[model samples]
Target: MSADRETLEVYNARAGDYAQTMGRDPAAMASLRAFVARLPKGGRVLDLGCGPGSWARAMLEMGFEVEATDASDAMVAEASKVEGLAVRKAVFEDIDDVARFDGIWANFSLLHAPRAAMPDHLARLYRALKPGGVLHVGLKEGTGERRDRLGRFYTYYTVAELTGLLADLDMVTDDLREGADKGLDGEVAGWFTLTARKIVPDTEARTDTA
Candidate 1:
């Protein structure tokens, strides 16, 4: 099976437990809160790969118009339970909108995409943003792909590698950090955190054209 499908199956089977286990650290939440604070007031934001919707809820409480999405139906169901949150079912490639969102919180989700498709996916994300929009994505730092003990697939990216992948995109770094994953599952997880702003073009190009 493809990595996306395989990972979806695993997540569907464990969505409830996974949702329950997804608790954010106070420090991380505080940082995210500050990040969102920088956006235009009541901005439209997309919570890409919004597992269980905690961030969506937090963003809603902070007064942003939030759209949350995930590929796993179970995950979508879990996230939809958050009343008033707009939820959808979609994979990474399903994102093809142009100038739609002011911000996108990818969290630890985009790691499921295949390495070969990373650039195209990043470009789609770039096109999906409004002028001067910001983006935040996280990934485990490594080379190539692997399956976790839970049977979920992950495509890792080194800091330099990720930097290279993003270099050609129309964005500038806000923050990129190398660190440990806070060991949520009892093991050290190498991680790379990225925050960036989509550069506003003088004249927008046709990003999606025949």
Candidate 2:
């Protein structure tokens, strides 16, 4: 399934508020820098679920081709205001590219999808990346699915669970970070970031008898 209707409405109505709360942070940009460092200069990157286009704008400034997309009309409108950034209206399920992008930044976005749909969404993302391409995923560190006090739906996951899911899709988990922070909801929560790579053809078919 896609994003929940109430969640979309909340985002539509409070887009500006959310942007204000999520304004660019130097530490966050450091994470982005690390992500881009793994990618070649001028590589094409997809900012899946880009909110307010901050990261997309940063990547554009860093000289990479970026496709910034989100499902919310308000978000797309906000992201389009940035000059030279190609923003589009798209949901996670709308992604259907095959080995097209050198990297995908799915930070804090796919957590909105239902837990049952995560495997398919992850597989689609795997196919969307070039072999050996990098993928960055940020998710709330927890269990099960529920709605926040702000009326937004969330699907949480443990690090091990997500690691297994990525393994099933032949993506190698290489980097991880975890911490707690207060969100727009005024509540401190745990979250984790995972950086993985799509397995290349030879690695996919290799047999390890050791």
Candidate 3:
């Protein structure tokens, strides 16, 4: 397993490259648009692991109040440079806010988290969202962990595994789709995209079919 310190170092080293690559992806922008369309108008959004603030910028353009955060200081600096974004440097494990967000966009960020930490991360995400708040996660579709040439660690998940994990948290998944496309590294990868909604107080008693 890659240590958190090493992971952060790898990302910090490549932060500028990652930001540049993300800026040129039209598909990523489209996906961000689709994710935001599911949210209510003028709601608060937390872009977890927001790199370079692109997604946060898009959300701001769509009339949502957004807070962008990442673990790497370099990334936070880049994100803060974007106009109209509130950027912070934070690790996912350090987030302890409760019921403050109307939506959480975690695009391709959780994949860096160790599998053992996924449950707790999901719980934190649950706690961060308001009742009926939306959570959109984009993950690579597979299992186990691997390191790319750049030495960044990545964890992949199967749909059933991811769905089961979320279901255990009382969050009902509203949609799941396969999103295979060429990524920044010029390699085709399969993506599992899910949109889950927090169960409201009155609806908590109902069973989730997702």
lDDT of 2: 0.87
Show pairs that collide, candidate 2. none
Window of ten residues with lowest summed lDDT in model 2 = 201-210
The best candidate by lDDT is 2
**Pairs in steric clash, model 3:** none
**Cα lDDT for residue 86, model 3?**
90
What are the TM-scores, per candidate, against the unseen true structure? 0.89, 0.93, 0.89
Count of residue pairs whose backbone atoms collide, per candidate: 0, 0, 0
Find the 10 residues in a row with the least total lDDT in model 1.
201-210
lDDT of each: 0.80, 0.87, 0.83
> Per-residue lDDT tens digits of candidate 3, residues 137-197?
8899988898656566789999999999999988888567777877655678888788888
| Tens digit per residue, CA lDDT, model 2, 1-210 | 246788888888988987787745444566688899999889999999898888898899999999988988898888898888888888888899999999999988999999999999999999999987999998999998999999889999999999999999878996688887788788888988888998778656564322
TM-score of 2: 0.93
Estimate the TM-score for candidate 1.
0.89
Return the candidate ranking by lDDT, descending.
2, 3, 1
